[model samples]
Target: MVFRTLFSVIVVFDIVSKQIIVIRDKLPYLKAIVQYKGELNKDYPDTYTWAKFLELGKSVEDSVVDNIIKEQKPGQCAVLIYTSGTTANPKGVMLSHDNLTWTTKALLDTIGSDKAEEVTKCTISYLPSTHISGMSSLAAG
Candidate 1:
């Protein structure tokens, strides 16, 4: 698909087993590694299990985070969401950093900051990470 090719690489993490079957069908080699060796793609930006991903995070230095913050601009793409494609095939839609921030800020402004702070906050995420409402909930919390 266009979106898949847009990136030089793509990694799907089956942290909660949600994506395992999809990976098995599309990239059997990755599934084989998981099944036979209990191993995952060890390269940067490749698929890995939740625990392995966390372990690999240890190797990332603080500079990486700093650089991310320093380099990121509001217009840059922050999330990719796919349409249900009721009329046609699914298409990838890029959501910018400003879009997400604006959504969260709007939610807070609508709810009123004082009332929001007084209420206990909880966030539930259903992944592919592009779920805007989920992102808004997390950001607001």
Candidate 2:
């Protein structure tokens, strides 16, 4: 009985540990994706027709792309988007996992990211993905 209890405890602990690691690693990626999407939606509403968005999303795998992918849990912070320094003292906008993930997946599905080879073939202008505009461009590329 003692051995069984210990085994059960270990299994539970292992599962919990794995969960934590997955969440820790993925939540940020998810947020990045969402933020990327939010930027896309905010800037290019007309470009992302429903059909185009779906085409972009289906083009690549989550693993192939480098990004955040986990949902944020209670008491967890997802992002700190702030105003540019020139404006009123830069204030941080805290976003949740839902805000980030949903936005990212939505945008990427519409816009699209691509490989160097793909870009070369398609005449894509390469840009970093951290900025909203850049991400959209990368997605398009």
Candidate 3:
């Protein structure tokens, strides 16, 4: 399931100890662990907190970040948002970099081009990134 898989990835950070043990116990080979924050950080071995993550980003050299960004080809998977599993297991939606831009564009077009930019400036990205609309709002904001 999307939750199981994504949960494994997220468990390294915002975690539930018991659930992690159960999942890890059940599926030993499932490890979609951390990256970027600490690829091989000997100083801080574990995952970084939300604040530390932001700090790490700021610490990275601008040119290095820019080069990394430039290296990414178009249509690459940017965000893997999972759907709400009301009746069954949630579905993982693989959204591309271009898709994100298009979502923002579509949202703006619907709001009317004249006031789209104005409205977006005040837009708040509060919705959970579990839905396409939420992802769209994030892109818009």
Candidate 4:
């Protein structure tokens, strides 16, 4: 019984740790529109606009990430999107795990892990995730 229990615990930890590693690779893409309770509750001022940011974040959490994670695929189709920001100009962009990996490698060539390691803790600072910069940042961790 003791052996079985220990084995089960190890299995569970291994599974969860694998998931965290996958997410860690793509951590840059997710930006929090609102302050988290755990991090913000200490030595932080609560402002009126913060409420709105939370609302927006909740909306996104419900619609985007929730829906995306619901699908489990060994390898998924690439998501192709267009970038149209404040400027009326729009351009097509395609993203997949392959693209993300290649881009990350290119980035690594320039800055290396110096900046990447320091950016462990990241938050989303912008609204309207329909832009290329936002999507690229989100896709390539």
Candidate 5:
């Protein structure tokens, strides 16, 4: 329900359903909360409810976080955005950490904001999460 509240679209599948329409349509993989009538399936593959997914964050060890941070580099890919197939088939565009950081800095400079801590900022993101602009906005924030 929390995920549904955050996202406009929710792809629900019945336990006995033969096909998931979104997946069948070749849409990008979406974060989902599967619905079932019987007992919760702990061993279900690639399935997680919003609460269950959030619980995973609580269980992460500090060392794991530290190791992830240590593994990151400026040139490493931060995100991959698939372009809308307006002209041709959709293609994934990889954005590096340096690319995102540079864009964020450029945005701040253009807005005459010296530091993020200098002022309060509020944003209401309406663009789809898959879009480059949307991803950039989230990264900049």
Candidate 6:
């Protein structure tokens, strides 16, 4: 995945290339859109704005959502987090929903917080969202 930073917004690019490899290489990938501008760029066709994503979400039926939720399991992979490439290429760490929930519960217990909502309402988080530590804080709250 290629992430292009524009201001505080990050644009996800399907093809992580320096040039227009989509046309030259005939790569099979979707187009990219600039989220801030809410416009489709010729160079990036696979991207969609946040608004578009929300719109797509709104189109999903409640039954479909319920069905997906029912299919979810604690042992299933919830997220694939990429490690910081300090030595080699960044490696993806697969974390299950159970793992995150367990960590969250442990953190909350350690902090003596019975209600996550209360802590979340007052907490000011400054950690990077990409890191596990940041994820744990967010999940705990």
Tens-digit lDDT track of model 6 for 28-139: 3424433534344443444465667568679899999999889989889777656767999777677888888887778788777767767777776676655666787887
TM-score of each: 0.63, 0.30, 0.64, 0.31, 0.58, 0.64
Off by over 4 Å in 4: 1-77, 85-91, 120-141
lDDT of 2 by residue, 13-88 (tens): 2333334334443333221111113223333212333344457678788865544444436445554444445966
lDDT value for candidate 1?
Answer: 0.59
Give the lDDT of residue 130 in candidate 2: 37
Worst 10 residues of 6 by lDDT: 1-10
Question: How much is the lDDT of residue 139 in candidate 3?
Answer: 66
Q: Root-mean-square deviation of each candidate, in angstroms? A: 6.4, 18.6, 6.1, 18.2, 9.0, 6.6
Model 3 clashing residue pairs (backbone):
none
On the 0 to 100 scale, the lDDT of residue 68 in model 4 is 76
Give the Cα lDDT of each candidate: 0.59, 0.40, 0.60, 0.42, 0.56, 0.60
Top model number, lDDT: 3
- Model 4 Cα lDDT, one tens digit per residue, 19-123: 433443344433322332223322312221344454655656556786776763534435544454358655555566556556556654554557654452462
Lowest lDDT 10-residue stretch of candidate 3: 36-45
Q: Alpha carbon lDDT of residue 129, candidate 4? A: 41
Scored against the true structure, residue 12 in model 2 reaches a CA lDDT of 15
Give per-candidate clash totals: 0, 15, 0, 3, 0, 9
Q: Candidate 5's error at 60, in angstroms?
A: 0.9
